[model samples]
Target: MNSTFMLDGEEVPFTPGQTVMQAAAAAGKYIPHLCWHPDFAAHGSCKLCTVKIGGRFATACTVRAAAGQEVDNHTPELTHKRRTLLQLLFVEGNHFCPSCEKSGDCALQATAYEMGMLTPHFDHFFPDRPVDASHPDVLLEFNRCIMCELCVRASREVDGKDVFALSGRGTGSHLIVNSESGRLADTDFAATDRAAAVCPVGVILKKRVGFAIPIGKRTYDIAPISAQPAGDPDTGNKLEETP
Candidate 1:
């Protein structure tokens, strides 16, 4: 018999070794998350994908789905928690949405909209993060990084380049370049490297081109993020993320 579990009162089938978030995402179900990237080992740091399984809270990104289990997602209680988390993220970063090139296509912005976060409930931190325009072909906007570490995982796993890492803890945690100079240009990072790409925020941006795509015509503009496919249908389980 196929393994199955209940998510938000709906039966979700899962293949062995798949986490709750992976199965849910693959099955057209949405669970809020940021740190969980495909192919890389799951990082449950974000806690945005937290779900209640058997009445206990757990991060769906790291929890393996077992048969006959009930997982609570899309609940009123959970929605409020997600909203608070979103608000925290907004305040933690200098995310000037109107001015950011990633405004429309940004997963952070899109997820906020989906969660109905009308405004940031907390005061903005406006942390004094610096921008690295040292790389000839790429820009690093440190202020916008939420420390999801997608770039870190993609670099080490896919590109085989340890280009990035997170430094500090709690509020001080931030993305760092794996170079003595602590700049992206000082590293052997190229535009083609996955570490130089796959940033869900404005942290890793292509140089010389900003707002090339109109706001209304961007990736998350036409479709809600949760409704979008996490993996390519033609690639046979291949995920959209790479280094």
Candidate 2:
């Protein structure tokens, strides 16, 4: 028998070395998250997956699961916190969803909707990040970046390109290209790279193929992010085809 933990009053089974998020995902339970991807190591940057375990708060993605542990998720307090975080993310970036190509398919947008973030409660930063259209095949819009570091990790760990890195500190932090020219065209990044496909927002977009899929017919349009199966990497664009 596998070791089990209680999540929202339901028993979720887990093997040794699995985190709370991993176990809950394996049990088909949805814990709202933006920075926790099964393909990568636990980052614990986004606190949206923070759950109360044994009366202490912890990030589900990094907290290892133990037998007979009780986890409190989906409570009013946690939901409110998640909504605040979403609102902050929305305001920090110029996430004008209606004008964005990744509007419907964006994990950040979908997760915001899931958390019922109707309006950006905080003041908008409106950072003057310029759009990089230097790459012949890809577009780099830094305004929509949430500092998740998915692209940074994918480029280094998977593609071995080291094409992306986070620069600056605190609120000034932003994504930067590896090239001295500070442009995507100067780097060896291709459309087929893992970093190209790993962005959860509208930051790294392919050129000339915007709006290929109608807004209403996209991934999150058909089903909410909470309904997506855990561990699935599909980000709603459906641009990549399975071989």
Candidate 3:
């Protein structure tokens, strides 16, 4: 028998060096997480993937899966915690989903639905974040950023361009462009770069292409968020392409 971990009573086998999140995703088990891309190292900032391992709490993305370890996911307490996190994210920014361009295609919006978040319980921050439209082909919708850091990782690791970074700390933290003018146009970002496609929200958009597929026919609209593929867009589990 292969080495395995007990995930909610189901046996989830894992390979050497695999994490709980990785093994779970490979087994087609859904675990809530963000700021974790297979292409880059796990960023435990999101705290959405917390799971109980042998009665102790741990972040699934960073915790290595070992044989015979008992893992508890998909429990009422965990769901409630996730719901609160989703609600906080909603009220932290001006997430006007009804009028938002990424209503259906956005991961943040879809995740809220998956977590059963019906309302933004907290008061809205309504921070006056500015949009960066200096880029000729792309727009940076700063207000929509959830600070997942996918764009930062993709730009630096995949595209080999240090075009993005998070500035400040705590509530003051924000995404910044790597340019003297603090404008994306001043940096070497392209529409085809990984950073452009890695945003899980409507923070990055190709100009003049708003709602080309329409709201009702969008990606998440066709299926619930749970129906979507797991992990940071399947980058971690993808098979290597022969060049």
Candidate 4:
């Protein structure tokens, strides 16, 4: 018999070793997480996936759901906390959503809207970060990075290239690219690699495809990410054909 655990007060069965995010996603529950992408290694650095497990705030990416464990999937207080964290994320970096090409479809932007974030309450950092546009097909905008590490992990685990890394420390920490040379074009990174595709924010973007979809027709413009069908875009999830 599969072990059962309480998810949002209902009993659900899942394997032991799977992380809480894995278990929740399997059960069709949307757990707000940024660094726990299934295609990459879990970096648990982003506190966005924090869940009250066993009465403590624990990152879901690192926590395992044990048998018979009672886990609260959603609560008013938890939502508030996540919103506050989102606010911090907004102010910590240079997130000019209006100018970003990934604005509509970005996960961070979607999560911010879902959390009802209107304005960043915290003082903005506004650090001047260098941009890497030397790559032929990708643009690395370091200023907009929230240090989610999805790109870093995708490079290492999915694309078989350990190109990106986190440098510096504390409040000033940010992403550093490519052998301390600060150019992604100088590295072995290919345009089609998963590393170039895993960015959830506008930090790393496809060169020409950013403006391809056009305004009022992008992913989020059509529907909020919560309303987006949770399936493969190609096969399981069908794109609506325009008349």
Candidate 5:
């Protein structure tokens, strides 16, 4: 028998060395997260997955699962905190979701909806980040970047491209292309690269196919993200048509 832990009053089984998020995912329990992917190492930057373990808060993606431990997830307090975090992410970036190409299929947008974030509580930063359309095959819309570093990690570890990187600190942090010309065209990034596909928001978008899938017919459009099973971990948002 596998070791088990309590999550939201239910038992979730886990193997040795699996994190709480991994175990919960394996058990078909959804833990709201933005920066975690099953294919990559846990980078606990996005604290949306913070859960209470024996009365203390910890990021589920980073905390290892242990037998008989009580994990509190989807509680009122944690839900409020997650809503605040999602609100901050919304206000920090110029996210015009109604007009964004990634509207219905966006993980961030879907998660925000799941958390019931009605409005951005904080004042909008409205930072003037320019779009990079230098690349012929891809469009770099910096306005929607949540600084999750999923693209950066995917590019380096999986695709071996080293094409994307995060620069700056704190509130000033932003994504940048790894090239002398400071443009996506200067790097070896392609439309099919993992980096191009890992953005949970509308940041790294492919060109010429913006509205290929109608807004109401996309991934999250058919089903709320929480209803989707945790087994398929590609991009966290199902944008590609698997044939």
Candidate 6:
């Protein structure tokens, strides 16, 4: 074991391989992040959990802390940058929250409200993305993906199934599923797979639960994310907020 260090002004002991976000979460300080789930391997690709390490901004999900290192949890500079980052995520992908099923309990929606982002400063890309509803019990709308890699990580690490992968290059990059099948229904995907359940947006949804809970009583309707509490350990942090 390595030791404890200053995490958001609190000392939390951690092993050598654990990331800063894990340490913070272990200490009960919830830092908003989309890609860095506790059950999956940390990708640090979202750039949403950028925290002040030393004096500069670094992704907390990947950065391992050394002993005596100081981590600033809350700062105006970090908040400004995070808000801008959320804006980019909002406009880059096709996040049509209104028509989607994962509206209230969506992590992206929750994080945006928590960060106090009122508007997206950039122009919407409106990428003509495709949707794959071929699976029997699941629908995948690639248009809403934020590239947080939660599904990817869960598939490989947790489920031991490498079903999804990111392809293309640069600004045109997007997610591709299965072995060039192009359609999710063509793959050996089950309704209970980790990838299907790990999606944080409308990108992936269960067909049976589309309108089961109704809109008015939905997760977001009951709480605007900021008011919601951190996830419990048992539920894998699956939007278990009280109404």
Estimated TM-score per prediction?
0.92, 0.97, 0.93, 0.89, 0.96, 0.87
Ranking by TM-score: 2, 5, 3, 1, 4, 6
- The per-candidate count of clashes, in order, stands at 1, 0, 0, 0, 0, 1
How would you encode candidate 4's per-residue C-alpha lDDT over 90-199 as one tens digit per residue?
88898998887776767788778877888899999988898989989778888889897777877887788888989889888889886657788889988777777667
Ranking of predictions according to lDDT:
2, 5, 3, 1, 6, 4
**What's the lDDT for residue 17 in model 3?**
92
* lDDT of every model, 2 decimals: 0.82, 0.89, 0.83, 0.74, 0.88, 0.75
lDDT of 5 by residue, 1-243 (tens): 899999999999999999999999988899999999888999999899999999999999999999999999999999999999999999888999898888898999999999998899899999989999999998889999999898999999989989988899889999888999899999888888887777788898777777777779888888888888884555333554332
TM-score, prediction 6: 0.87
> Residues 108-151, candidate 6, lDDT per residue (tens digit)?
87778788888888999998887887888877889988887777
Off by over 4 Å in 5: 235-243
RMSD of 5: 1.5
TM-score of 4: 0.89
Candidate 6 clashes between residue pairs 3 or more apart in a chain or in different chains: 104-220
Compared with the true structure, what per-residue lDDT tens digits does model 3 show for residues 31-83? 88767777789999888899999999999999999999999998999999998
Clashing pairs in 3: none
Name the candidate that leads on TM-score: 2
Show the lowest summed lDDT stretch of 10 residues, model 5.
234-243
Summarize candidate 2's per-residue lDDT along 85-132 as a digit string, tens digits.
999888887899999888788999899888888889899999889999
For candidate 2, the TM-score is 0.97
In TM-score terms, candidate 3 sits at: 0.93
